[model samples]
Target: MEDNSRSKNRREFIQSGMRLSLALALGSVSGLALSKVVKDEYVWQIDPFECTQCGRCATECVMTPSAVKCVHAYDLCGYCDLCGGYFKPDANQLSTAAENQLCPTAAIERRFIEEPYFEYIINEDLCIGCAKCVEGCTAFGNGSLHLQIIHDICLNCNECAIARVCPSNAIKRVKAENSYLIKGDFSKEQES
Candidate 1:
């Protein structure tokens, strides 16, 4: 009788284990379905028009180095040698010296385009999305320097951490097909 009871207990345990495994699989599938829906309909993006350059994009994101980065609208850019986006407003001199650079990371690289026109290129890897350059450019230049979310790096969290803390309410969901709210059109580069 004792042996029979032991076998019955073992059978009950096995049954319970099977039930739990089925439940877990069903739950996982539902989660995957929800995520798929989100991916298909929308993606996280920043509205450059509403952005106030409040310096939160760098710190509010879940990632150590936030997914947001600076992008240049070259069409709107004057390509000035002394770029407001590149140099500090009160810079002692308009040089590439660390002290004179507006960006803390020196992410904006100034390349000589011609006699006085210097192209500013963003190294996304080095950018921290502090928006100091954005602020400077908007104040003094053509407002070509804008912060954008690099979708490749962005996790598209269901509730974006940066969006929650954004002072200007700039971050929002946009359609996957039209994910970017670019200040300067980049279609010409894409065509080439």
Candidate 2:
């Protein structure tokens, strides 16, 4: 009878241990799943490293004005008075005249910082994401002006229309924190 009682207790103890193990295993899986969900949060962005300065970003976006906009990495900028992103190739003068402007929309505004240093500002309201400035910047100056998806203006479509037709295959869903892939000193630029 004592042996029977001991055996019964042993069975109960084993069962309790198994139950606790099962619970722990289930809890671990749940925790892992939750972490994955949080880590996988993604957003649509243009990979400037892969972008070829194609004109499609302007026309292919579902949004009328398009979410893609030229962003200047000031740290990467040469601050040249004859900024390639701001001025046309054959521009006779280094002035703010419409004829001298590379951007058709006049979205890029040049501000005089010093004698030779100038600041280029993108007027988001007027920008059409045409890549004219981007192309010019890449060809003539340090590639400070690159295209990026303006999250505030983006529709965040389940499947981005621009991504489908992207010739360089530069547009895609990226983890939220890794979205803006700029060419140079990207981490430094993000700190500010």
Please give the CA lDDT of all the candidate structures.
Answer: 0.89, 0.88
lDDT of 1 at 155: 90
Q: How many backbone clashes does candidate 2 have?
A: 0
Alpha carbon lDDT of residue 87, candidate 1?
Answer: 96
Best by lDDT: 1
Residue pairs with backbone atoms closer than 3 Å in model 1 (clashes) = none
The 10 consecutive residues of candidate 1 with the worst lDDT sum are 183-192
Prediction RMSDs, each to the true structure: 5.8, 8.3
What is candidate 2's lDDT per residue for 126-154, written digit by digit as tens? Answer: 99999999999988999899999998898
Q: List candidate 2 segments past 4 Å from native.
A: 1-39, 187-192
Candidate 1 per-residue lDDT, tens place, 89-181, comes to 889997888999999988989888789788899999999999999999999999999999999999999989999988888899989898897
Full-model lDDT, candidate 2: 0.88
